[model samples]
Structures are given as structure tokens and as C-alpha cells.
Target chain A: GDQVKQSPSALSLQEGTNSALRCNFSIATTTVQWFLQNPRGSLMNLFYLVPGTKENGRLKSTFNSKESYSTLHIRDAQLEDSGTYFCAAEAPQGGRALIFGTGTTVSVSP
Target chain B: EAAVTQSPRNKVAVTGGKVTLSCNQTNNHNNMYWYRQDTGHGLRLIHYSYGAGSTEKGDIPDGYKASRPSQENFSLILELATPSQTSVYFCASGESQSQNTLYFGAGTRLSVL
Candidate 1:
């Protein structure tokens, strides 16, 4: 069984549009982090959240540990945003390794 | 921001050959991790270390081993490579074991023939 599950395995968005990606955790996690893996295969850290919402420019993320879910919203999508989005959670039993979701492949086109 | 670098961006190894992937982080973070990414599996942890001289097995550590000899370096070893071990490997470093942010390396693509 997967401790972390992501929805909408893949998505396509036109430039200037908005979309949301989600991750659901079955385990009791304390925190969550989001990452964007660019086409060049570099994983860039996006946001790290606890139990609230955070906004950074055109990207916003929310984490609800009580409900065991997290959401990443992209506003005004750009071609540069085309990449794979992954969410990882920190669980008590997961040790130093964060449990990761299957990831959402996002393709933004002009 | 932490800077994690992985060596040998691409590698091809014969079956039963030994392969070692290296990682170096300049941030001096206490936690470092090794993970493999596949098409459908996303990113799965193979090993992690809290600091120098401390290595721990991760979720998928069956055919792999790890060594952390110093605070800035970590290595993942495949003693006997197999086709199943073909994947993209990434190294990450963080300041804490929990509630921490991680910085990742560019990733190493390994193909076992």
C-alpha cells in the first residue's frame, strides 16, 4: 500500500491558465514538501509546508495534516512550468526518508 | 540554498559489475538521502544518512548499499548490477530529519545491461 498517493497523474494547461495538483497521505505525517522536476531532470524544491497555506509568487500550496492531504496550485501557468510535480511527507515511522507520491506530470503550453 | 551535486550524470554498467554513484553537498546539511526514480514508481528512497558515519536503509534497499564517510559526501553502491537497477538516481540534503526542506542534485541516469 502506498502511504502517499497523488491524483491526476498527468495534466496539460495552456499558458495563463491555472491548475491544481493534490497528494493524499494515508500515514500520519507531520509535514509536506513539494518539488518540481524540470525537463532536464533537475529536482527543484518548491515549498515546504506544515499545516497551513503558503503563497510564493504564482504558486501557492496548502497542507492539512489533520485531513492528511496537500494541494499545490499554480496560477498563470507558463511554458517554463512544464515539469513533473512531486509531493513528499514526513511521517513518524518513515525515519529520515520522506515518503513520496507518484508525482504529477504537468505540461504547460503557449 | 543547499547545493547538491551528483557525479557521472550518465552511466552504463554490465550485469554483475559494481557501480558507485557519488553525491556531494555544500550546505553541510545533517541529513542526506539517495533515491531512484522510475517511470511509474516516482521517487523511491534507497538509503539515507543523518551525518558522517551513519547510514540507514530506506524503503527500497534490497540490491543497494550506501556509505557516508563525511558530512559533505554520500555514496550509493550497486555491488552486482542488474537490468532492474536501471533508473535515474538523485541525491538530496536537508537540515533536519523531519519538517525540513530538501535540496536535490541533478540526478544520475544508470543503465545496467
Candidate 2:
């Protein structure tokens, strides 16, 4: 089984709509981070959460260690949101390194 | 925000050739990591460094070697590049040894012909 499994391996969204992506972890996690890889190949950090929810602009993320899952929500999706999203987690045992998911490719169309 | 950069955004190599991916961070971070992304495998750790002159094996370090000569620079080398070794490589920097934050580079796409 994968330590981290991301849902909606691929998604096609209509511009201005809202959507949510999820990540489930088999390993016990202490912290989680969300990233958006743009078309230019640059990965932009979205949110880094401990256990609660954090909102940045039109994006909101939550990490539930108890449930072993994390969610990334994008509101008013735009054309620029068309890229891959990854959720990485750090376990409690100590290790700065992260384990990433397969990623969710999103394409927002007009 | 901290900055982590990778050189040669794109590369193409032949089978059995040598390929080196370079990364540099100006944030003076203590931890640096290299990850490769594939179609179904996501991003797997290939190598990581705690500091200058120190490197450690990662989940997928079979055909890869890593080097850390300075605090800001870390390199991943493929001495014998194969088609299977071709993937999008990412470099990241973090501030702590344990429970820290990470910043990533743009990424390096290597294609083995």
C-alpha cells in the first residue's frame, strides 16, 4: 500500500468553479505541506499545516493526523490553476525529508 | 521567501551516458533533498544532505550518486545513465534537522534517449 495516496489522479475543471483535492497517508504524519507545480515547471508552496486549517487567498488546506489525511481546496479556480498538486508529509519520528503523493493534475478550462 | 534553484531546466542524454543535476540554495538551509517524479510513482527521494560534505541514501538511490561540496550547493549524479533513470528531478531546502519547512526549485526534466 502507498504511504500517501492522492485522489483524482487527473481533473478537468471549469474556470471560476471551486474544487477540492485530498491526500491519504498510511504513515503517521506530524506535518503536511501543499504545493502547486505550474506549467513553467515551478512548484509554488501553497500551505504548510500542523493539524488545523490554513487559508491563503482562495486556497485552504487542512491536515488531520488522526484521520491520516489532508485536503487542499481551491476556490474560484482559474486557468492558472492548471497544473499538478502534491501533498508531502513529515512523520513524527523525526526526519526533515518528505514523502510525496502521486500528484493531481488539474486543468481549468473556460 | 527562501530560494532554491536548479540548473539546466531541461536535458537530454543517451543511454549509458553520464548526467549530473545541480541545485543551489541561498537560504543557508541545513537540509537539502533530491527527488524524482515519474508517471505513477509520484516524487520519490533519491538523495539528501544534512550539511556540507554529507550525503545520505534515499528511497530510490540505486543508480544515483550525490555530492555536497558546500552549504549552498548539492548535486545528484548519474554515473551510468539509463532510460529508467530519466525523470523530472526536484531539489529542496529546509531549515531544520527534524520538523521543518521546505522550499523547492523549479525542477529539471531529463530525458534519456
What TM-score, over all chains together, does every model reach?
0.96, 0.93
Which candidate number would show the highest lDDT if scored against the true structure? 1
- Give the poorly placed runs of model 2, Cα more than 4 Å off: A91-94, B97-99
Q: Candidate 2, what DockQ?
A: 0.62
Chain A TM-score, each candidate: 0.95, 0.94
Highest-TM-score candidate = 1
Which has the greatest DockQ? 1
- lDDT, candidate 2, A8-107, per-residue tens: 8999999999999999999987889888888887888888889999998889999998998999999999998899999988733333788888899999
Candidate 1: Cα lDDT at B40: 86
Give per-residue CA lDDT, model 1, range B15-99, as digits (tens): 9999999999999899999999998898988999989999998889999999999999999999999999999999999887445
**Model 2 CA lDDT for position A65:** 84
Cα miss at B11, model 2 (Å)?
2.3
